[model samples]
Target: MSGEGDTPQAIRKLSPGRLVIASHNAGKVREIAELLGPYGIEPVSAGELDLPEPEETGTTFVANAELKALQAADLSGLPALADDSGLCVDALGGDPGIFSARWAGDAKDFDLAMRLVEDRLNEEPDMPRAAHFVCALALAWPDGHVEWFEGRVDGTLVWPPRGGNGFGYDAMFLPIGGEQTFGEMDAAAKHAISHRADAFRQLVAAVL
Candidate 1:
């Protein structure tokens, strides 16, 4: 993965202009679009492009994000942004770190993933099961300049997953300072204090 210093300041100097968000996930695309809305950047989603989903072969969030962003930029000949996010659990030794999405195999079976988390922690009732959602955002320009930003919200896992608002692990994860899981919060509420929102703040500082 490229270090923070590797990013060219020239990339930041470029106008916001039209930007492409390289993600097929509608939820992610919507969240990112909302975050970038204030900047007056016209955001387009990869799902709307009929582009092939690039394989995420990178080992880290930043790597994956950069890979996707660069690929999209090259494909569309436009500046692109990409984010890679996942939940990491302490008690599980981060078993689902990069594999968070595929924990239940290749079907993207999130229900099974939630069940696995519960089953894994069932034996260790006394274990301190702290977890966090991590988001890494990468901005790639057509000229190969790239920048990265990261944000995370530390929280703990709750069983029997509550709420039905957000997707994936949101139903089972509570932010550090909150009692309700992210899934319990409304979209506006979740966006106000989400890991993705934090990362977007950093991205705004760098680009806007």
Candidate 2:
């Protein structure tokens, strides 16, 4: 027999019912809700439930995601799902990976954050503009059970950002082999190939 943390227990399947989306960001909540649309799971955001935003003290996306999910599950007394995502710039050694949102400041001013990223890249004039988006999703039950899934999408950083369709660093990120940045793509288009979508695919396969 193995310890609870290390035991290879069967993956828990989510029953169709109310689920808490453990996040306050409207963009993230909307995206997640859309992805969960076909699953028959009723999704409610943490903001809607007046849940406090948990301080993300974890160093990695996985840690932060699990932290949020568990907190929501414990507070709401329902199964909860959380996502922790960030942009990792190759030239900057994956800087802002877990602190992506913090760079936007308290106002959630991503324009300032995007400018900062561009300015940093300017300092390294010769370095490649390669970057990637990472998303970690954690699903937790009130009883302390959890499952994790992660995804990544590689791309390059563009200058002047692009469209206003998506949020965060979406405007500056051009997916590999794609001309339009994520900010330029419509929700459905972006959803088809985003890091979040990638993670959702894995979750769907395992537990949805």
Find the candidate with the highest TM-score and give its number. Answer: 2
Candidate 2 C-alpha error for residue 31, in Å = 0.3
Backbone clash tally (model 2): 0
All candidates' lDDT scores? 0.84, 0.91
**TM-scores of all predicted structures:** 0.92, 0.95
lDDT of 2 by residue, 63-164 (tens): 899999999999999999999999999999998899999999999999999999888988855878999999988899999988888889999999899999
RMSD of every candidate to native, in Å, equals 2.2, 2.5
**Which candidate leads in lDDT?**
2
| Model 2 lowest lDDT segment of ten | 1-10
As a TM-score, model 1 comes out at 0.92
TM-score of 2: 0.95
Tens-place lDDT digits, model 1, residues 88-185:
98988876877787785677778899898888888776888799999989888888888888889899999889999888788999998898899899
